[model samples]
Target: MGVGEFSYRISISTLIVVFPLLFVFRLAQGQLHVVGSLQPVVAGPGDDVILPCQVEPAFNVAGLTVEWSKPDLRPDPNDRLSRVDYVHLYRDAHEVPDMKLPSYIGRTALFTDSLREGNISLRITNVTQEDEGRYRCFIPKLKSQTRFSIVRLIVDPSLTETVTTKAQLDPENFHVPDLNEEIDNKGGSSERCRLIPVVVLCVFILLCFAVGGCLITESQKAELKKRPI
Candidate 1:
């Protein structure tokens, strides 16, 4: 073969062998992603809030280690793995106690029921003003750090309080008399008023009877005293 022809044959062989291997290699490394919402999750202080996160392609993640952390917390500089006190961590289908931060131990929980559906959402109960910040939902086994997403949390105290206040102050919650009921109550009052005079008349009649009996008894006693003494 000529020089150009020989070079062309070698290039074709290399392409045939290299392309299939590259395709297989990429296929073996399946895509693992942690997807989250772009919008800030608004919550009130002392309210339960859900930080939504899901694994893309809907793979069962019951065995995988999932971590939810506040990015603002100071990370340990000496740790090469970049592991810090995580807000919540799930491993081997259960929550790991030692891996969780003290503040987040009782407050955070994962939805284990949705793990089969690739949902790794974190629920934070009794959220405080300090809980407002960026949260990262990550899986350490997923080699690429870019797969994890950040969720911004916002705590609106006034908005929640206003809603609670409005609920408490609702007209439906107060005792408002109906028109028919008010009329019935008025009738009842008039009936009670009418009964008062009747009761007074009966009492006066009883008093008159008692006085008459006393007078008769006294007159008899006076006659008896005059006769017997």
Candidate 2:
């Protein structure tokens, strides 16, 4: 082959190998997307709460690393600490006890069965007021890149409404009886006004009848007084 033809063939072979590697590298660098609740989660004291987080475009998370930590966990300024505690940790489909914080060791658990479905939700049982804070759910380098979701936690005290008995509710406290009497008086006045019109109509009819009877009697008496011719 000629020198130019040889160089061209070498370049084609090099491109064929290099292009796929570059494509794979680019695919590996793709970012990981995570999803979580937009609203803050409310948990009553001494209750269990689930902090929901999931991977978008679901992929097998069984072999991946899942880390749950409190972003707003502030230690005392006097305490010496190089790193904050992790609430829960899973590496290669198993819990890493050494990585778990002392306080969260027994109270927190991950739902492992749903890992294939891409659910990385953490359940915290026996929640306390100190558990109220923003938590970070993260997966580091499972496929492409590190992904994170934020969860806001709110702790609320249990509430109960007091029910009042009938004895406690006094009827005298309300002016309902006086108001009802006033309404009845107004109704009676309206009825009396309606009866006035009816009474006037009846009196006019009686007067017309009396006048016709008197006229008939006078005509009959006059006819009787007139003798037959």
* Candidate number with greatest TM-score: 1
The Cα local distance difference test for each model comes to 0.64, 0.63
**Residue 164 of model 2, lDDT score:** 14
lDDT string, candidate 1, 1-229, tens digits: 3446545655665565556555644543554455676566777788788777777657788888888877667757887786567899898888988978788879888889999887787888888888888777777665432345566688888656322111121222222122232211211112233244356555555655665565556656766777854
- Tens digits of per-residue lDDT for model 2, 1-229: 4446545755665565556555645553443455566666776777777887777657779888898888666556786864566899999678888867787878888889999988788888877788888777777765533256566777777622222111111222211111122211211112233244355555555655565565556556766677586
Quote the lDDT for 114 in model 2. 90
Q: What is the model-wide C-alpha lDDT for candidate 1?
A: 0.64
- Per-model TM-score, in order, reads 0.55, 0.53
- The parts of candidate 2 lying over 4 Å away from their true place are 1-31, 74-81, 144-146, 159-229
| Number of clashing residue pairs, candidate 2 | 0
